[model samples]
Target: MRLVQVAQHADDLERAAAFYSALLGSEPTAVFDPPGLLFFDLGGVRLLLDRNAPTAVHYLYVDDLAAAIERIGDRAEVIGPPHRIFTHEDSTLGPAGHDEWQAFVRDSEGNTVGLVSFRAVA
Candidate 1:
């Protein structure tokens, strides 16, 4: 099955919206007034921001790793900078001779999010 929605706690709607907007580099696709929730479209899935939402660590793929790190700046907490998590030598773990790069950062609400790229481990 495919993921449809991801929920994250957001006690502060405005703050959460702003932080997510900057972090995601896009505004929410849909916002609910009654429930006071915000939805960020992650292609097929949606990031739901509300009080009853569950806390989750989500990873987003980025084409330009350096630019993404630079854009993040000092807003959220950086758990770690870009690094080669898996290299061609670690092919046994996944496919043969494939490298993966990743970095971790915490959102305003303390949910750890990872930025990843499977293209090149640079």
Candidate 2:
């Protein structure tokens, strides 16, 4: 299945926009002033930012989960350390001998963001 768009709500537009911009390292591809929305391009997925949408949880893929978390600075509160959630050799999410790790954090707006990465067996 292909995901076309994902949305998150923000009580404060400016704060949320700045927070996500720095956290994602990218600016919104589109923004609407009246409804107060910001959109980011996430590899073809349109990340919808608004003050009215229901709170949503999204996972972002990163090469180095730990470093990405650290780079988020103190604004993002770490909910959990990176843990092996899926191992191809043990589960069906991927091929054999590969591992998928995930870590959870709460963004400045209190939305849950998941950090995920794939690691080779060493």
Candidate 3:
């Protein structure tokens, strides 16, 4: 089965919206203020930001880890700097002969988010 939706805690919807919009490079798909819900379309999966939801750590794939971090400058607190995590020797988990890089940042609503990217071995 494929994944559908993931919810994360947000104390302020508007602040969360601005932070997410910049990091995702797109506006939210939908927003409801009365019940306090914000939605962003992540490759067909729904990313819901709710006032009552528990915080969750979600890892997002980026084309360029450094570029993504730069784009998110000052908006998010860089908890973990960019660094290589692993190398794929086979095509099972990731592309062969590529290194997996990851970085972590804290979102506006205080949720830790992981940013990931793969670069060919040099």
TM-score of each: 0.80, 0.88, 0.96
Which regions in candidate 3 have their CA more than 4 angstroms from the true location? none
How should the candidates be ordered by TM-score, best one leading?
3, 2, 1
lDDT of 1 by residue, 1-115 (tens): 8889888888777778878888779998988877778899888798898877778877888876677767767767788888878676555654456577788888777778888
Scored by lDDT, the top model is 3
- Candidate 1 clashing pairs? none
Better of 2 and 3 by lDDT: 3
Q: 53-108 in candidate 3: lDDT tens per residue?
A: 99999999999888888887788999999999999999998899999999999999
Better of 2 and 3 by TM-score: 3
- The runs of at least 3 residues in candidate 2 whose Cα sits more than 4 Å from the true structure, single-residue gaps closed, are 90-92
Off by over 4 Å in 1: 88-97
Identify the leading candidate in terms of TM-score: 3
Better by TM-score, candidate 3 or 1: 3
